[model samples]
Target: MALCVMMFLLVIPASLAQEDMDDKVFLFPKDKHTDHVSLTPNITKPLEKFSVCLYFFRDFLRNLNLFSLASPGTGNTFYFADSSSTNTVHMNQDSALFRTNMEPYEWKHACVTWNSDTGVVKLWVNGKLYPRRVCMKGSSIPAETSMVLGQKQDSFEKKSTTYPFVGEISDVHMWDYVLTPEEMLQALNKNAHGNIINWNSLLYEIKGDILVLPKSRCPYQITSKSYVDNGEDVDNGEDVDNGEDVDNGEDVDNGEDVDNGEDVDNGEDVDNGEDVDNGEDVDNGEDVDNGQGCL
Candidate 1:
């Protein structure tokens, strides 16, 4: 049962193997540090109305790039950056929305949903909705553009490391439509799946000394359900009272009185109810006669 819970709750995580991932980081010198994710088609793509979400845990209070989905010269430019530790949301040519509550050294669920028709952008941080307007304002993201992560992109090949991300990022998802606040909350629970980028089986490339780390806590969990007995029975998959248990509505005596009873397999019943569930009950419904009853 514990193993089943563990399986549903976690998959042992790719970040748990980050010790081996060190060999894959760009490993640039500290004097000139750089860490980024070079976007392949699967990482980022152009869309008119879209929403993207990711889970990030920053290790330091430095500037960093979260996502850079923009064309340098001729397309709609939309980007997110942690400039000087201030989470800045940018769209189009130099328009930006600044956010100031993101904490360093913590895991955060960040989501941005945008629509080109209205140029409206909605940012969700850990499931809280923050709405804005008219940033890109009727421009479509270029189909073939430079998309990068972990560093602010000045251009396709030219990215600024002044805010190079130093930490772990995971659970990235992108949908071609704006996600509602409830849907964004579901993302925090890892309940929702992205049609564009499913983080469970993601394909991307990481650069520099950025190390992927396991999430500090499991993103999903199963809560024990309460039985029908109201608060009368514990929710440990069993019900001892009027409530129905997950196994069935089997009744269990608490032994508070001397006549308390135990679970009946082939046990006796005082009411002559023939608690008999085997033999004829198990064998062709003949009779209570011997029919070689097996559990």
Candidate 2:
């Protein structure tokens, strides 16, 4: 029975561990040496060109590694990272620096693509493309590899905690070839699927302090809901209140019955006069002057 059970366990495919992680995020709560995520791509052949896309958010003002792919020979086979002030991308132990201003506590979308024929590297941040660079011309990234997030792997047997990632990361995808601009936009809009590694159907394992949670915001869903809510608010609050109740019930009717001298003896006219004076002097004239001048 023990032999049968062992055989059953051994026969279990590694793909069985994969889970659909659509609309989910990997939250790295803090920078810990042991905290990391292992990604399984099951790549059978080496890749001469590839693209990687992910969205990340950080409140910590420090450098962090976003993606790391390590092979038997090269540890920094493909590494993506960013600092508090700038961004850096590594391919085959060669790296390029990008002087892009990073806003604190803000979520950012980054996509990187590399072609070995020309050794050209391209980076897109939040749908904006950065200047192109080249590295490791004609080199191919090996397959049967180990990939991780939240930490950088230096070698097949060793990993580095230097520039460990903190905060949240989501929507990770990897393609076997460089994505076209349209495909990149589709990926950014969450409309494209990756052939190599799909976020919607991901094979990943958390090694340490990583939490898989629902993403905080869905852009299209949130925007659509907001438009619906805004429509309802405007229809109910503005049209009904301003057109019918406020205009007819309060403004027109009450203007004639109370404010158009009907309630003059009740101090309505005197209060109106005072309000008008205050409005013109303080609210309209001085307020605008002070606001424009001070600003």
Candidate 3:
């Protein structure tokens, strides 16, 4: 997962102390979707005009949250997926025009801008400008923003979380004012600094098991029902032996045997033992092999 975020066009020179840590890769474990990074508030006076930018990547459409901004009464929810679309860009308590198509498993840049002067909000994906939306006109977001990332918050101070993002994210940046197309293009091409949350000097805290990778090679293994092989839905999280693809309905219901194999039943009780997983046999489902191997 790589999120390449940039800010204003003018790249300000910073001290050696203000650089992104070489530790760029932060891996959130699949088992711990509740994990998140809580950022200290950006105490920059009037929270009127601002934009949140980042790069993200994932392979599933499972209601992943990208960011949130909550005020006293009104708030905005930025998310990736909903019940409607797989790759969506949605906002809350706003208007009707807020949706975009974002592909998965590839790095893509996204930015959302809100201006209180005109109560206009806009979103940009890659380099395209989406339609401007009307919301919170002439009003500033609460100075004390209940900001959150990688999870959806339904209330201020992040009181409720209904959706948690499961993927890799990076290069987060926030700007106090909207960036011009030229500035946006410059930031997209060159390096820039964030008035607020700079990826280079990011201030954040991690919760739960989030693997921070300093290298490009990943060592974690994931085995699940969604694993696909050459357009075949053959893997339902079951084990395979000696490079042999054995899931062809050979061990259930009919108890029929077409060839020599293990776990083949003959209507007579055959309780095959639990299958080995991660070097351990984990029992699941009912073992009715009459006297068979697995129950």
How do these models rank on lDDT, best leading?
2, 1, 3
For model 1, state the Cα shift of residue 253 in Å: 36
Top lDDT prediction, candidate number: 2
The pairs that clash in candidate 2 are none
Please say which candidate is ahead in TM-score: 1 or 2.
2
- Per-residue lDDT, model 3, residue 91, is 48
TM-score of 3: 0.59
lDDT tens digits, residues 166-200, model 2? Answer: 88888899999999999999988778878888898
Q: Is candidate 1 or candidate 3 better by lDDT?
A: 1
lDDT of 3 by residue, 1-295 (tens): 1233344322432311244643374565563556776665556586777777776655566557766666556545433332224334444555434556655554556777777788777777776787877776776665666666676556665534566666666667788888888766655543555687777776566766765555243222233333222222223344443343344455433344333345444332222332223232222122112111110
30-84: candidate 1 lDDT, tens digit per residue = 3224666655444255678888887665656656667777575733266776643
Query: lDDT of all the models against the reference?
Result: 0.56, 0.74, 0.55
TM-scores for all predictions: 0.58, 0.71, 0.59
Angstrom error of the Cα, residue 242, model 2: value is: 16
Model 3, global lDDT: 0.55
Model 1 — which ten-residue stretch has the worst lDDT? 286-295
lDDT of 2 at 223: 21
Q: Model 2, poorest ten-residue lDDT window?
A: 286-295
